[model samples]
Target: MQGGAQLPLPNPDSTPAVPVSGHSANGAAPGPVVQAKESLLAAAAKARKEKPAETEAEKMLREEQEIMRNITSRKALKSVMENAQGISYTRNLKTGWKPPLKVRQLSEDQAQDLRDRFHIIVEGENLLPPILDFKDMKFPAPVLRQLASKNISRPTPIQMQGLPVILAGRDMIGVAFTGSGKTLVFALPLLMLSLQEEVRMPLEGGEGPVGMIVCPSRELARQTHEVIQGYITAMKEDGLPELRSLLVMGGIDMRTQTDALRRGVHVIVATPGRLKDLLHKKRMNLDVCKFLCLDEADRMVDMGFEEDIREVLSYFKAQRQTLMFSATMPMKIKAFAESALVDPVTVNVGRAGAANLDVIQEVEYVKQEAKLVYLLECLQKTAPPVLVFAEKTADVDDIHEYLLVKGVEAVAVHGGKDQEEREAAIDEFKAGKKDVLVATDVASKGLDFPDIQHVINYDMPDEIENYVHRIGRTGRCGKTGIATSFINKNQSESILLDLKHLLQEAKQRIPPVLTVLEDPLEELRELEKASGTRGCTYCGGLGHRIGDCPKLRSQNREQQRNTKDYFGSGGFGGET
Candidate 1:
């Protein structure tokens, strides 16, 4: 082509010319193109020959998996050998535990007399006598000192019987009224067991905790952990080998808990969900956990933790001394105890679902719209350091805000709040900085708030058991307190009837509204009295007999629906 000139077009039928292979028409070698292709091929070959280095996280995970595999293998081998020898893994584990000769030497007459005096009823074979005083427990000096420091001079009815039962290494089912010192019954024994285990064989990394306490709520778990820590601190001060503990619950960093586990712990106080999560992830094992206490067992079951509890129990390779303690024992808890505990002694300090005698329960009829205004009046009925319980979180928040706007120093907690917020509210209320606390049912069970002058139910709970627990916040540790519950037309008659019976049982004044509600089972109860029997052996609800128990029927329906769903979802290969 001529420079700056147009070239002539070629014919359509003419043959096309081709350039040489790997060379441009400009007569230059394609060195760069060739090098680029070679570079790509070399890189592909290198990639095929070598693998990328693992990240730090991957390396740590692999190491953990390897360790877990080794541990599992060793456990399997031990189990197989033990099975072959027909030896029971847990038969000899608790042999070292024995009641003191003084406790054992008590005659049956004296034991019966003590039980009668304390109003304690114990059922089980080979039962030990109840301890009349804290000194009768023969606890370690540090433990006794801790008790003394708390000014706990004597054991309550439940503690009187429960201490001996647990200290003797017997599985137990403890039923008592709320605020009956049920915690110490199991807590002290757990500490003693952990100390005993540590003294015999110090725990190494991934070896323990020797004891575990499963609480129904995060707040309860934290409280139990603090209690154990107090005793642990006392023991350490007295020159005992230091014992480590961990609080495992949701709403906190898992890494912190995992790190604590890596260091080893002698006692673990945990909630079911978090504990099950860690156990499933292999972050902790129950191989060395011989003592397992289910605090607020009924509450846990009510919260739908029965399956999680069972799964956690399955992780144990050997039998564990299982203890179930609650203020109320429904049929479900009884069934659970039968399946979980081995020859458990049933220690009943008072009838299940009974109100605390020390609490003066006051019921009132207030319009639903006016409850907020009346809440302030209720607060005026008592001094500061009062607890107000509402059934819903939204109501709790509303009350909290209302109280604050009205110049009342109030803090609120519920399941909906962040963990930090909940903890802060509880801490403030506990530290006596807050005058009042508004909360949901989450705070109803197993929370120990000392010196709580009053508990006002802004709204009545649906279940009678919850009412018992809510009012139980006050009147703790042999102190008299008051519970003011406002009931309106919106309240359920069933709960109202139950409340009426509970008030009459506690010998408290019943409001006109509650008094007007007729008890459906009054005739049945009279007949039962004539028959030398009573109402609801299953749920302890005086309003209904066993066959008519709402809780029992509800649970049965739930189970049946679950079964139908399971089968319908192809759980088994069969036609519907």
Candidate 2:
């Protein structure tokens, strides 16, 4: 199992406890399913006795409602499942072979014949099955030449799948290991559609461009923006009709984004929140968007941006081609696809949630207190170009301080750090002035620093899936990478377990040691006991899941009772 940080504390609330795989709160195996029912009742009673503000309870209820709303939204889910039987097509153009060239000395007629032959072959080239190409390789030339001047010569598998689908103007869902060039998958297509449109249509003044790429993080949006810029640069080089692009995301002044959008961009890559903010105000238009791509679709779900995604899509016509790309496809991703796409082509480049092929993975079982020691050992051993991902802001600070004390050049990046510090820290890391960069999720999104050899998860992610995102920082651009995590005695190993299942499914081997690892359930129970309430697994509440909740049950029973009363109490149920 991948290692995880078992939270030290519990929530103090009257909510049913989550049945973690570890021991129960009393340091014993959970007595029984009956005991679970009793504990929830007890917790509920305790919460009532505490008589906390109704306002807090109300807030909690609202958050829960929103969470379900986010999950239940059928758009992405339906779009995905409806297409789940999956559509298949075949092309025999060529596999593991390049297009043939004949530059050998030839007569003019032969040259013309060769050129005609090239066109005929390309026009008639039968493409291969999607699954085969996804297993390996990058994009074709028209896309590569555009990427080359941008200095990106090789394509990742995600790009390979996405580029084709995007150009075909079909809905697409791309899932692969993180840092597998997922951005280019959507961005290149976005550029192709727009730039190609600029060429095909006499933009002699068609209302600007007709595609948009939306991302959740500012850094990611910016990374995507830069890639688009590279493509636009290529377009200009090719002397194609001029294409324009812009970035719209948070932490940046809206005035700038508003002005850029007002000036008109064919492709606007923005964060969901900010983009929605613009859309609601009638400043952004999707009425003409022929193509749309959601980069990091899973992050938007995790960051709770479903409403924004829906809101943005609501502005577009259903006929628009939508593409959603994520490093990993969780349930939320399926839901997002349902709401957004159509009978689209689906591409699975790598086994979902697995580490990058370039990244070597490892874990060490250490005590929470000893996490610092192992981190130091890793820093000392690594040749200094490394990144450290901490699960919390405090951990980021502590690790940064420790590294500083060790005389290792290091800096931290997170939400609490001022914009200047954050930017400076990223710049320093990018400039190679910092030996190590300690960060939170902020660094995990869309960073493209080259030569980074190690990604250390200082703290394992609470959501097991985030493991893919955090470790994505290294092993990018065809480079080899390594990821190491420190696991303590009480930390949750569900992540490792989940990862093991995912990897083994992909035909990767599981470590023999993991087969006999400590009990995850017991560890979770201890942590939950330490925390006032077992962190709510249902809606991530403090103590309970949705199905087991008393309030929900009461609502159901009340609903049934009211139905009987309305039916004239034929003891209606009996009569029926």
Candidate 3:
């Protein structure tokens, strides 16, 4: 909090850091349910493509589309949706997005707060008028002095930790929740750095993105770009160069992005994969960028874009100050930060999943057969507009179908649906045309539905990080959100342990169910045998081999004990 003068930049060798995780770079098989959905989709695709005749271009496009269909990460899906240009192609590209805001732009008051924040950092003291740094940060004064303030009074722990390092122009990795204002950690520095250089127009040969942000998802990309624009534009009208920004995601026109790049912009926010495609084709350049950022880095690994991110990281100047931010620090992201940051400072804003603090979490252990009834009952009594999450596209479909049959107006969105359908469904939900949106994890990250009051985990996520992301969809922008999970009899102790850690950190109430259950996501052997799969290790895997087939083995051990009791003790066993 003291001596805010522009902090010194890190050693020259440092910078251009990106949160790089190998999770983004692999070829892995789909989850069992996802595999089943793929099978269902293959039949659906076959039926949809009834016409046998096709041009070579058409065939190639279809193949591309099929490959894209297999990618479910919202960011990956958005990359594809943003690329479709033809009418059907465009519709096909629709990875349902309703812009976060439509009416108002950044207010002058908001813009001034940004300027004042920068001044406070650069001078290590408030200019002329003079105020305490702690006080300035506490109430909206510094930022609110102007009209239309985008006031964020107090800096979160992460910001307080990294603001000095960023002002110093040092590379950094921030681990914090989605709503923790991690965006400003690097953004403020980059804006200040931009002020040091001469503002210029786009150059010829269609090159150079001065400030580029590589994000895991298009929704994040779009949102990040808009946030940057808001901050930069506010600076511009106040007498600085208007920060130009271009959005490059998966789905829209490549030509349009190319044109935007060629026309030149001050900053570019993009999805790693699509941005790679553009860069490989020499459609854009990173040579001039003095600053780079990789946001939602942990999620990128979840979406499988590590290689793309690495490749893109290579494009930036080695010394461009890099700022990498993520919600969690999994091994993959940690490795990326190690490789990408140059002796960078690591700032974690609060506990990584601290947003869980304001969230009230509950888990219900119910029979799968009774899931629908329980879900409906819970919503009818516990809350309204509960965001139900499923593990697979098929589950979303089944839930949607069942909800409709029960006269519940529910909407569903997944990777398998075309962009238009996804968009239509999302729009309907936003417009209140639908009461519940049954979705896969794609809806969990970077999408804001302010009125979302509750989140239902129909299928608990294998990764606890995902659980954090799902709960974030609600309780955003300073509001509280509730999350209820449905854990079946067969689920995992690991999940409970993870939940315990999250709950302890977030200050949320612990459900008594955490004490009684194994992994609900796990299947019982009996259930699996009956279903011709395997009983869930959680409930019994009917035949589904998950992780390493640990649940099934446990079930087998239980069976042996039963056999021992009958044969040795009762002397009436059928077999020893």
TM-score of 3: 0.62
Q: Which candidate is the best by lDDT?
A: 1
In candidate 1, residue 146 scores what lDDT? Answer: 92
Model 2: per-residue lDDT, tens digit, 80-146?
Answer: 3233544222321111233123322335465335334322111112222221232233333444565
Lowest summed lDDT window (length 10), candidate 3: 86-95
Which is superior by TM-score, 1 or 2? 1
What is the Cα-based TM-score of model 1?
Answer: 0.80
Could you tell me the lDDT of residue 383 within candidate 1?
84
Best by TM-score: 1
Please, what are the lDDT tens digits per residue for candidate 1 over residues 433-542? 99999999999999999899899999998778888999999999999999999998898677787788888888889788877777766545545665543455556666
Ranking by TM-score: 1, 2, 3
Give candidate 2's TM-score. Answer: 0.65
Question: Cα deviation of 303 in candidate 3 (Å)?
Answer: 3.6
Output the better candidate (1/2) by lDDT.
1
Model 2: lDDT of residue 380: 62
Window of ten residues with lowest summed lDDT in model 1? 71-80
lDDT of 2: 0.62
Which residue segments of model 1 deviate by more than 4 Å? 1-95, 530-533, 546-548, 552-576
Off by over 4 Å in 3: 1-151, 195-207, 232-240, 353-355, 381-385, 404-409, 423-434, 504-508, 517-576
